[model samples]
Target chain A: MTNSNSFPAIDQDGYLLSRTDWNPAIARQLAQAEHIELTANHWEIIELVQEFYREFELSPASRALVRYTQQKLGNDKGRSIYLMGLFAPHPALLVSKIAGLPRPANCF
Target chain B: MKSLLCISRHSPYGTAIAREALEAVLAAAAFEQNIALLLMDDGVWQLKDQQQPIAGIQKSLARNLNALEMFGVDTVYAHQPSAQKRGLNTAELCIESIEWLDDDQVRQLISNHDHLLSF
Candidate 1:
């Protein structure tokens, strides 16, 4: 397991300070910090958000996150409840943090 | 919800205004507000498909605009004369479903919105 010191710099909210520092290993560690375990379903959404960041060069707010997921992953996996079940409390914020994306601009 | 019309009148990468305008539209849409984008003046350059910003220096504005629809910003109006004056080819636009408007139509479009934000 990667030690706490082995992780890259993060913000107060635990999001990676630099997107380049993100990797599957770092993502797994970040998810662990949020008390989430890595599952294939979680990885799907994680990779999708990272792809979203790469395409738009901006982190998505909740609405955009759901819509983008729907566009890419189909409705079964794109609903807010589905996402909230995976990341709970606040899906957009938590998912972005775990994916090493900057805090979503319109998350609040 | 009040309808907002965001007019983007600057070229992408020339300054931050164009991108800022786009962000405001997206932000409003994220809030579930009804928002539309109007690209006029130099803003027509934002839809030009052939953009490759310096990797670390600037993000691609066209790519940013692509997310507008997904963000619930479905209406995108482009000023035809501004595009013509700048010699932007329709074939070169990166986005689809652009509502092209002449000057009179643009004025009418301006009148149709409950709020107007110019960039």
Candidate 2:
């Protein structure tokens, strides 16, 4: 049975399922690949992703994601670079991964 | 086909970067291109919940963001770390929930997009 409240769903066979479920270990690995030091901000991003999944039922694109956060938090803390810094320190890749959408088609 | 990505890293009230970013995105969307917007660092401020602009400010970005959907520019991303740094949590803001991408992912996003414009 699928638990609507849970982030990852399970099938009758008891297998975990999700579009992109990153465990803490996996998250850590990805963070290491990006040379980002795990911090409260990174965790906040993860938490927001989980929340977004619950509200939208789908991973949001980059643009929508920022707007969403800004709405939730006040402007004092929602700047693009600060948000970008949490994921990797680089601005572009941060948007791609968080949105769970394909990388922008023309950044290169 | 032409694609445009506008990056906003400033707040709504201070300076015009956020407002300009919104204008650029709206303009690109009007062109009927695939347009995406990203907010990292201070840019996340553009999405804050309720902003009352002082009388002297030229314009406000809070209104502009609310109209992104009208312009067909939907994709929005924000940095989680930056939000926390500023003591702004999700519930406190007014915009939609943005996806949080790390640095590596940001690089990939830039590479994939056809055009990139930052304000």
Candidate 3:
């Protein structure tokens, strides 16, 4: 079963379980896969994923995930360009992979 | 090639966001780019069987979705959870039935696509 504390720390075998355990190695992998360099915004998204998991028992949907960040960082920071820059696909999926929860449904 | 993915997460008449998203999708399709539309969360209500626009407040968006196929935009998907949340069934909606996608699937779709433009 999935829970708030399910995600493993950045160390250990967390990377195998969840992409959110992004260490330098995993970050490099993500950067290569998405064909873009990692930036602070990317880290911000990963951090937001962790924060979201702590708040909502379940992983957020794409919109909720964005709104959650908007509520936290203000509207300017919550824009899709900024959010998308961090999570190539959708914020929820990116966060879920990192949060160690099952990917969100309906993002496609 | 540029591909546009439009994700709608609000209900019609509930807010202007939903209508705006639909309009954006239509506009993208008009540009002759590959476009896919995903309706999730409260956005699924836009596809509900019968949607009556609240008087003169706004126009019903159901027809716009129904016309997607004619515009050469056939890919439409809705989250199963969203559908169940509002007790919506595919048959009730006028648009073509969409395959329900899970989180992992959605992730893969987004990653594989060239450009994802969500509304």
Candidate 4:
């Protein structure tokens, strides 16, 4: 089933309506909610961050995200400023939500 | 408004301790509380320029630091010795808004606050 216009139930923040019901389409919609267009780079970071959660069972905060990104994506793409621009407003929160994962612990 | 001093004494990137503390500060400010954020010891590292936490799959802690001022948290402080220990000066700090404090001033700062919260 595709989400037509109605998004699933998310918390006050635009996270996930149903954690398990995540599809690529849902991520696009979620990004739309934040007014961000998911570019190729955006998808790369989002997917990698989600993979981080799967591997570690925890959402990587800003610090962890940078290190992991550097390792997998290379040093250039791992910059904090670049990530901030992509996930503007709230990077960890938006990235986690876009990736169909829960909020990172210890994130403000 | 209650006077609150929040001491952030953790390294900037290892964990979310500093960010969590910053959230607490922002929340306090939203409630119209008089809040002061202090970065001391290793926490001073949070203010270093050229931080790149995103590659680690995290967000920038510096952005939260910048947001504190907008929340009316104008009284920000960093330990002088802590900054110096890392060979850092105010110019090298990500936040130039914060004042540097010495031991005596730190003591006075503690007394000035009605409640002191450590992060």
Candidate 5:
């Protein structure tokens, strides 16, 4: 199963082969396949995720994301529902996809 | 992976909690658990930058923290009040970029983890 629009080559699980390969175009294409329209909130999470990887050298899992977001973005934007709204069902998976981060290790 | 928070409440050297908590964290990370390490109370002393080896009693505590990052334990934190009580500052910590949290944030950190282990 592949997208009609060519995406920058990703791994079998939809993770980018190289972090440098990610950009806005790649993010938009990924979100489109997930039936999502990228909003400001989506981009916020995406940005935070990349920064997290840079700082921690690992993708933030769901619970870690909630804590980090709560500290940085405030309580309203940090809960599971807010993340689920932007990237439903599997917020960690979807957020990492859009952020061009590696699939969060524990996401599956 | 289960989110495991290892809370170290005792300082290094005096007791085994420092090394014990670190060992548990390493084990959890080896299991591919999402692990967070929080230094509270006397535990904040573990992050103090320079410590000479305690004769033959203990290995360098700094080495343990560095090993933690390599072991895949990414979220290292220190409780603010705890550090302040001990007159410690984040800038002088052995681990680079350790998150400093107040009591409220510490409570939130606790709630974020699936498992809590205290040492």
Candidate 6:
């Protein structure tokens, strides 16, 4: 277990080495690594991705993430453009990263 | 689109094959292929309701299976005799729209698909 002072160990690719090592602080640190400043919008998607991991036991692929977001957050917040604006260039992978979840297995 | 069928014969959680099969199906569906899934033998256990995978050790196969329709893999089948032998009722399945088929129908299903992927 990592102490509260130091950051948790992450994989070579910057994902948390252990899901248990994650917390809000860790999420903030992770977002920093991705050069993202966490906002209410970011937190909302991050929380949604974490919930998606909890329910599905796996990270959502890009398409699945879009559909899931649409289902839960409605068409307005669910579109690719919306998710991209928050976590662009690969929202599924990037969101999962900031959310402290594993890189989506089906993403690549 | 060419029709593809994925046949899963392993029990979920015993190994990763069951999950792999499901992933393949979902991937194919995502690509807009005409795909169907068949859960036979111990694979029928995948559909059994109330799956509680040990937290952090495994993921809930039932919940993952529930996402089939959302992924566009709408045609899912379960072997009726396999479920009966295991004492699983249709009502107890995690996914509600799964079509149950017997031996002869299973044969027909096999012959109907253009390609068969067995896991």
Each candidate's interface RMSD (Å, one decimal) is: 1.0, 10.3, 13.2, 11.9, 7.8, 1.9
Which ranges in model 4 have alpha carbons more than 4 Å from their true place? A1-108
DockQ ranking, high to low? 1, 6, 4, 5, 2, 3
Q: Kindly list the per-residue Cα lDDT of model 1 for residues B12-69, writing each as its tens digit.
A: 9979999899889888888899889999999999999989999988988988898888
* lDDT for each residue of candidate 4 in A17-39, tens digit (9 for 90 to 100): 45677889989988898899999
The CA root-mean-square deviation of candidate 1, after full C-alpha superposition on the true structure, stands at 2.2
Candidate 3 lands at a TM-score of 0.49
Tens digit of lDDT per residue, candidate 6, span B8-72?
99999989999999889988876778999999999999998888889767878898898777676
Candidate 6 docks with a DockQ of: 0.43
lDDT of 3 at A50: 63
Write candidate 5's Cα lDDT for A1-108 as tens digits.
345465567899888877877888888988988899998888999998887676555576677677668777999998989998889988888888888888875446
If the candidates were sorted by their TM-score against the true structure, best first, what order would they fall in?
1, 6, 4, 5, 2, 3
Better of 2 and 6 by TM-score: 6
Q: Residue-wise lDDT of candidate 2 within B1-119, one digit each (tens)?
A: 77677778888766877777777776676556798988888987776876766633354456556556644667787777778888887787766656777777777777888888988
For candidate 2, give the lDDT of residue B2. 70
Instruction: Determine which window of 10 residues in candidate 4 chain B has minimal summed lDDT.
Output: B63-72
Question: How would you class the docking of model 3?
Answer: incorrect
Q: Which stretches of candidate 2 lie over 4 Å from their true place?
A: A1-108, B55-58
Best by TM-score: 1
Q: TM-score of chain A for each candidate?
A: 0.91, 0.60, 0.64, 0.86, 0.91, 0.93
The segments of candidate 5 whose C-alpha lies over 4 angstroms from its true place after superposition are A1-6, B1-92, B96-119
Give the chain B TM-score achieved by candidate 3: 0.86
**How close is each model in CA RMSD to the real structure?**
2.2, 17.2, 15.8, 11.0, 10.9, 2.1
- The TM-scores, one per candidate, come to 0.95, 0.49, 0.49, 0.56, 0.53, 0.89
